[model samples]
Target: MHDRFARSEWFRNDRFGLFMHWGAYAVPARGEWVRSYEHIGTDDYQQYVDAFRPDSFDADAWADAAARAGMKYAVLTAKHHDGFCLFDSELTDYSTMHNGFGVDVVAEFLRAFRARGIRVGLYYSLVDWHHPDFPVAGDPYHPDRDKPTAEGIDGHEPDFDRYLDYLHGQVRELCTNYGDLDLLWFDFSYGDLKGEAWRATELVRMVRELQPNVLIDNRLEGSGGEKGSIITAHPSEYAGDFASPEQVIPVRGLADETGEPIPWEACITLNNHWGYHAFDHDWKPAKLVVRTLVECVSKGGNLLLNVGPDARGRFPEKAVEILREVGDWLADNGESVYGAGAAELPKPEWGRYTERDGTIYAHVLEERVGPVALDEIDQESIASVRLVRDGAALGMAKAWMAEGNPGLALVPIGPDEAFSYPLPDPVDTVLAITRRSAPEG
Candidate 1:
């Protein structure tokens, strides 16, 4: 029997999640984007390992904050390109618990998140730099020195087979220790090598066998059938549990070919930097975060906003503050986001739409010089329009329908002289347009 992830209640209902990328690497405060970009030597990179002492590392606090921010699940880096494990794994001595911070991070997070009634997802990177057996490291596409090089593999002092054994052992420990996980978010694939493919498939199978409810990502499969071949190639066209749209948040109110708008989550960072950077103090404003969430939800996608805790294992004050602000916004109008589908816009460009039940939440992001034009929305579906900020009726029942189409007469309601906060809210206020029926001509 095929285990369909898209149909899973845990995934569809949870349209907002959190992604934590804290590790020994964050100690340097450079950025996690360095593993591939920076031409730093192994000795220098390893220095961060020694300095990775997270005195304030509190997994419960992180999980609690995530739950407060309306997040349903959290994905943490179990193992990154540096081959560092966040848990107590016998596979490698370069784990968080053994390295310096003697704490089982993954286990701690899992327990705390589960306690808060939130699902936990593990982010495991297939590209291991410490492993002598891991191939395709020196390739132009992937230039991480931590990844195994061809020459290093051939003249390896430590046995390659032994490394693979250790890797599998750690995987076993993670699955076995975590009771039951919601997702295994795998990153990077070593082409179609027999060994790599075999290990990936075996891992998926093993995880599922242990926890039948566990979900897997697209990285489990290679281009064509090789060792790692459980999922289909070209995941966007094919099927999967959730569409992991990285970095770039789509223009508002767009969808994939599946017609279901493709169950997606935009994994973005607080700053432009994914990891903590000393020089990068340009933290995104709380308003921008709210806008990002609103935009993602409007497109029927989840927002997995990322945060890189410092070496002390605590989120930056700026990040925390913004998250709290986002939480406050969600507390009031989350109905427009959670479990909502991409709503149909009247003109398809004036604004974006997100729907739940019979309500259509319109997000007007663009500033219009004249009156907001639209090709008359299906008024039969609309019940009433109200501002989400203060629940004020828009009084657009008759005005909603124009000559040719239903155009919006945006009378700025705030106390501003020019335009009242552009549709009357301090920040970006969602218009909760309640509808009576589904959209139809």
Candidate 2:
């Protein structure tokens, strides 16, 4: 195991977390990338900065929602690609403190989440569009990228070194001011702007010096679309502590060249956008969210589900409802997720498998016609089988119907040897299977 993996032991065990994408973009309610996507100039975008006051913003409420949803940790956007800082930074006047929103959003978030015993993390964007030194012309995802010169956006003679200093300074502030961050989520790296372009080694060294135990994402060397050198045998100094796969889950969890499992977390949005989009009502149901969380754990990965709060600084009613429903399911079946990882057994046709210690949790996503087949599991090795929701014991025996299949370990759905259609929990009916103890020498 890599030295960093030891530091990420807690992270690996934390199967689910909340990713908050709240920022000035929330004011527009279009999306987090509204400025760049709409090609809105800084002068036009200033409207959001001026109107950015989340009167109903309650950090405690946010933390409460996260806690109720079974989230063990959370990551909030301290600064996004638009160059707006949610915290009070002495180095820049373009922060929440200077923009009439007197509250230090980052500080409140940290205090509230920490009070609730949830590990806190901050997301800082490497690409700053509002900074004059940050090149705009010819830069993809920049509002003024199509302009003639790199300085066309702000025309300040583009000094990238100056921008680097500011970037490093802000990071230093975050590390110093925040009590103790559990993680630091960097936005991305693309084209020629990776690794040394951000002086990643020095930055990582500073972060480590300030907060030794904090976990970092691989975006300093790669983006959400790329896994970076962390997956290789020899990773760079800034290869990060874990691979962050965004928007989509990996078919199989991340692994190195040696086929050994590596730490990873999938960041997925609840709706179509990371920031609140009033028009995008296409929300993922609680069932899909629950199954996705199970899938990630079954593949030896964590899920950092996103919640984009609206401009009013409130979680959407639908989002809250879905989270509550997911929390309800977890309230009963959390044992199958928390501290669980990929089981030694193969993925079942009916559902997924997650194991911890001698216990294997079978997540029955689909209903079986007969008795639920425990494929590849030997009947002799089984110690006990019981429903995770309730401690009700489930009988394990070879049914008369399965006379031809002698090797298959079958567990009845209820009292009888046959399955009762429409599972008690349709989303995920978890069954805890305990392995028999080994014989003494």
How many Å off is the CA of 416 in candidate 1? 15
Best by TM-score: 2
TM-score of each: 0.82, 0.98
Candidate 1 regions exceeding 4 Å error are: 1-3, 33-36, 40-44, 141-150, 153-164, 190-198, 222-240, 251-261, 346-350, 366-375, 397-422, 437-441
Give one digit per residue, the lDDT tens place, for model 2 in 1-441.
Answer: 566589989888888999999988998899999998998778899999989988999999999999999999999999999999999999888988988988899999999999999999999999998988887766888888766555556666778889999999999999999889999999879998999999999999999999999999999998986988998889899999889999898998888988989999999999889998999999999999999999999999999999999987999999999999999999999988888999988999999999987699999999887688898897778889999998889887564655887767898786677546668799999999998898999
lDDT of each: 0.67, 0.91
- Residues 1-441, candidate 1, lDDT per residue (tens digit)? 133543456676677788888776787688875655775444567788878878888888998789888888889999887677888877677887777678888988988999999988998876676565654344443334454433553355545466666666777887887787888776655445333444654666676678677766555453211212222333332133555656777654333333324455677888877677777888889788877877777676678888988888898888888888888888877887777766665424645677787676776666654333322455554567677867876644245334445444333334332332344444465677665654578
Single out the weakest 10-residue window by summed lDDT for candidate 1: 222-231
Candidate 1 lDDT (Cα, 0 to 1): 0.67
Error of 2 at 391 (Å): 1.0
